[model samples]
Target: AQSVTQLDSHVSVSEGTPVLLRCNYSSSYSPSLFWYVQHPNKGLQLLLKYTSAATLVKGINGFEAEFKKSETSFHLTKPSAHMSDAAEYFCVVSDGSTDKLIFGTGTRLQVFP
Candidate 1:
């Protein structure tokens, strides 16, 4: 049982508010999780990752996620929202089952002026 589910399909925020994206996952073994962002017409870029090293991990663009093993969750958050931060985000899970990363449906963030 290795999979991920992004709770929000879309999130809208005003230009200076906080941002939160929820994700839940299940894994048979110890797993590694990742968050990635993709801008329009651009490839996906790594935001942050957690690999059994730390429960709280920080990524680029003021993004961070906490790996809660008991709850099987890895939710991403940002201190403040920016118009440029509008993009699609994906929660990923991988346990060496394949060379590819298992991606969630994705959550699209919309920032308004």
Candidate 2:
């Protein structure tokens, strides 16, 4: 079985500050990891993915995560937060062979000016 846990349900940041969102996971086999961002009332956009490839993965909008096998953690980070960055984020995991995906509850990012 594979599952993901998002440590925070919400994150608030001021414009131009850094952002961090924590996540943890458990999987029987090697897993595929992903981070997705959803803007207000919009569909999820793929932020990044880890396919047993790179430990340090970079994504769009200056977001990135490191896959830590020891801690089973993959935390998202951004150097600076933008007002437009206010949205919901999800940490996701997929079994190496399945089409189904498991999603974190969600983290709502509030950006203040």
Q: Cα RMSD for candidate 1?
A: 0.9
Q: Write the per-residue lDDT of candidate 1 for residues 1-113, one digit (tens) a residue.
A: 68999999999999999999999998887889999999999999999999999899999989999999989999999989999999999999998666868899999999999
Please, what are the lDDT tens digits per residue for candidate 2 over residues 1-113? Answer: 88999999999999999999999999888988999999978999999999988899999989999999999999999999999889999999997678889999989999999
List candidate 1 stretches off by more than 4 Å.
Answer: none
Query: What are the Cα lDDT values of the candidates?
Result: 0.95, 0.94
Q: Tell me, by TM-score, which candidate is best.
A: 2
Reference-based TM-score of each model? 0.96, 0.97
Model 1 error, position 39 (Å): 0.2
Each candidate: RMSD: 0.9, 0.7
- What C-alpha lDDT, on a 0 to 100 scale, does residue 73 get in candidate 2? 94
Question: What's the distance in Å from true for residue 71, model 2?
Answer: 0.5
* Count of clashes, each model: 0, 0
Candidate 2 colliding pairs? none
